[model samples]
Target: MTFDVKKEEKQFYSAKGPELIKIPSMDFMAIRGTGNPNDEGGAYQRAVQTLYAVAYTIRMSEKAGISLPGYEPYVVSPLEGLWWQDGYAGVDLNKKSDFQWWSMIRLPRFASHEILDWAKNTAAEKKKIDTSDIQWFTYDEGLVVQAMHHGPYATEPETVSEMNDFVSDHELKEDFSTRYHHEVYLSDPRKIAPEKMKTILRHPVKK
Candidate 1:
């Protein structure tokens, strides 16, 4: 099912702090890129490709009776981002026309690293259409602040601004190296209107 990039925000949980939270992410894989994303067509294309690959992994895992923590089986798209410039926390669209640096990581919940490694390799094999090189991570603990983003991507600035405010009001500091922009998509773009699509944007901040 194709998910709409814009629309309504779905139900999700997020918090701020230096505490470890239990997140049961379903089985999925991620592809990482480290250059300007827009400049590198391969990066963007592969990012999208990985999504399908991991989605299928979730289906296969369920069929095999493998249960994951926070095992919603739904696609979770959390981005590891860097904001060198002041105020903004995402891709610099204007300068990103050719060489945008970015990476896409997939989160899957499991009891041990053994299954996690297997899942990553399995997803890569299934999605052989794209580059097989990717990374696997078990983000067991970190400070995360998330919120539901309503409306279009163009209007995401407001949501981001609010998130920043929350961080400030709560006396949270940002850890640049570990800072990331996490997103979970629930609406199928092919089936929902742009204004009605929802996306959850989560950013990591130090408490």
Candidate 2:
């Protein structure tokens, strides 16, 4: 059976409305960059491309006779990102040029630094793109308020406002001291209609 995070971890990935939850530490293949994500062929787009390259390489390692202990067939996790801006409190969609982001994909438990190194080398050779900036690390998001956002990315502020209201109603404050504004892309923009897109928006919060 292929393990799917969306199905196995529904609470984390499928929130329909603003709600509070705790996120545990998890491993990821990440690449950091700055600038507008909407820019064609930009740093953010390249970062995403590099992330998937290495992620798929590790996922298919067994077929290449590379096996790791406790490895199992699993679905590649959705694309997730951590976003922030310098000297800004919360994300400002209008100021995309000032955005700093960590585009990443969750890795399975069996993934290790050795496997990641191998994957990066293989992907770099096969794709003919630099993968030197990729990183493997664990992140603990802790307490957060998250909701499933509908519609296009430009309309995210509407959902964000609702989440902020929920946080205040619950006496929790948005905290970006350690964590970041997180997003989980559940629907591929290419296949899904913009008005029907689904994105999990998460904000770190503290009581």
Candidate 3:
């Protein structure tokens, strides 16, 4: 069976409402960019394409026999982002222009730093795009509260408000120093209706 992380890991998806989960360590191939994600011709859009290009190159590495140890066929994980800004208490949906995002793809456990380097070079050569900016990141978000947000991106505030209320009721404090507003995109907006799009929004917290 092909290893599908989304199907195998329950926490990789979302719940109907707010739920707290202890996240484990995970590696990623990350790229940083600043600009509005909605800009059709912006850095954010280009960065996302670059991420996927590299991810797919790495995923298909086995065919080249230039692969990582313990490599197995697995579905590519969803796109995830760490959203924040210079001095914002939280991500301001209204201010996409100033958004500082760490856009990333969760790497399989078998993928290592060297494997990623090879993938970056391979993708750059094949795709004829700059891949020098892509970096390796290992993150463990620890404890966080997450929920499914089903709506257009602009309507995320409503879901965020609910997440905040749930956090307060559970007596948890935001840990901005260690964590930031994070999101896992489960729906492709271009293919899904605005009201039906799904995003798993999560925030790290401390007791």
Strongest candidate by lDDT: 2
Q: Which runs in model 2 stand beyond 4 Å of their true positions?
A: none
Give one digit per residue, the lDDT tens place, for model 3 in 75-172: 99999999898888777878988899889999876788888888899899999999888999878889988889998999999998898999999999
Cα RMSD for predicted model 1: 7.0
Q: lDDT per residue, candidate 2, 1-207, as tens digits?
A: 889888999888898889999999989999989999999999999998899988898788788797767789889999999999998887887789999999999998678898788889999998898999999867899999999999999999999999999998999999998889999999999898999999999999999
Comparing 1 and 3 on lDDT, the stronger one? 3
Candidate 1: tens digits of C-alpha lDDT, residues 101-186: 33444443332455555665777676565434544544432556677777665576677788778778878865546445555554
Residue 56 miss distance in model 1 (angstroms): 0.9
**Clash numbers, per candidate:** 21, 0, 0
Q: 40, model 2: CA deviation in Å?
A: 0.4
Can you give the lDDT of residue 70 in candidate 1?
42
Residue 52: error of model 2 in Å?
0.7
Better of 2 and 3 by TM-score: 2
Model 1 TM-score, 2 decimals: 0.59
